[model samples]
Target chain A: EAGVTQFPSHSVIEKGQTVTLRCDPISGHDNLYWYRRVMGKEIKFLLHFVKESKQDESGMPNNRFLAERTGGTYSTLKVQPAELEDSGVYFCASSPYRTGPTGETQYFGPGTRLLVL
Target chain B: AQTVTQSQPEMSVQEAETVTLSCTYDTSESDYYLFWYKQPPSRQMILVIRQEAYKQQNATENRFSVNFQKAAKSFSLKISDSQLGDAAMYFCAYRSASGGSEKLVFGKGTKLTVNP
Candidate 1:
């Protein structure tokens, strides 16, 4: 089966520009998660989507960051007026329903490297 | 709150040898999940292995295995017969199993270098 796929493997934008990162998860997967790692830091969770609903977004840093899962299919993370600290590798992952079998593993995508200048 | 730590920032091992990466976590929750992810030069976070908190026996996949201690909140990865392709950043992660959320809390990561 095809794993999670992300668009624009690399993105470069100015400090005040807007950038959107997209993630297409595996078919039939009900769980989608967003994560990112800044320089010399651990990978931090951003948010999670179960189907089309936002299950958990406590990890979201601020209002400038927004996440949407339209039609409960794919998800998007948009950063407005990006700051220099936003330059990092953003990773998207998905997994099958935990209630069902085989939800222990998460499939990750080729992260999108965002560079803010 | 949960936090994971990887004391060794970098580690090296000769090919065909064994290497262990240490990880410790602090969590009040009894039920949780632990994971080890490998990130190669391509910057892809690949799931190497995982362990359930309730499982007594360790989890193993091929040459990769985890020594998980729930009481101590410690989880370590052991790679046997290390290969050059195994060189990468290994991150230890923790997730609350009962929160109805699958959010993972990761460590600072340990960069493993395999010498041939």
Candidate 2:
């Protein structure tokens, strides 16, 4: 089985521009999550999705940031009017929807490095 | 509102030696999980090892193992016979086992360098 995969491994844009990062979780996985890591900071969770519905989004930074999972397959994180502080590595992870011990293990993708100048 | 802390910003160890990375977490939950993730130059986060709070025995995976002190709220990773490939940024993370909170809280990470 393939691990989580992300698109546009690196992105460079100017401040105030809009950028969207995409993630395709492993086949048959219903749990998807997004996290970000700023330079010199720890990785923080942004949101989570179970199927097409959001499970949790308390970690979202602000109103400018939005995440969606359509058809319960892929996820996209959009940052409108991106600011300089939004530049960082965005990571997407996924796991099977189960209550067993193995269900807690999340497989991460090669993060997309976003640079907003 | 749990937080993970990795005190060491960087560490170095000679090849074939052993090195331990320190981590401390603050959480009131009795049941939780701890994890160590490795991110190399490729920038891919890989799970190295994990420990479930309910398990009294420490977790071991080949050359990687964890020293989990539940009382002290500490989780440390020990790499035995360190190889050059082990060089990377090691992150300590915490996750609540209940309340349907699946998000992981990560530390700032510790960069490890293995000298040949």
Winning candidate number (lDDT): 2
| Candidate 1 share of real interface contacts | 0.72
lDDT of 1 by residue, A20-44 (tens): 9999999999899999989899899
Top candidate when judged by TM-score against the true structure: 2
TM values, all candidates: 0.96, 0.98
- Per-residue accuracy of model 2 over B19-103 as CA lDDT, tens digit each: 9999999999999999999999886889999999999999999999999999999999999999999999999999998867789
DockQ of every predicted complex: 0.63, 0.64
Worst 10 residues of 1 chain A by lDDT: A97-106
Q: Indicate the worst ten consecutive residues by lDDT in candidate 2 chain B.
A: B93-102
lDDT of 1 at A76: 95
True contacts kept of each: 0.72, 0.63
Off by over 4 Å in 2: A100-103
Q: Evaluated with DockQ, which candidate comes out highest?
A: 2
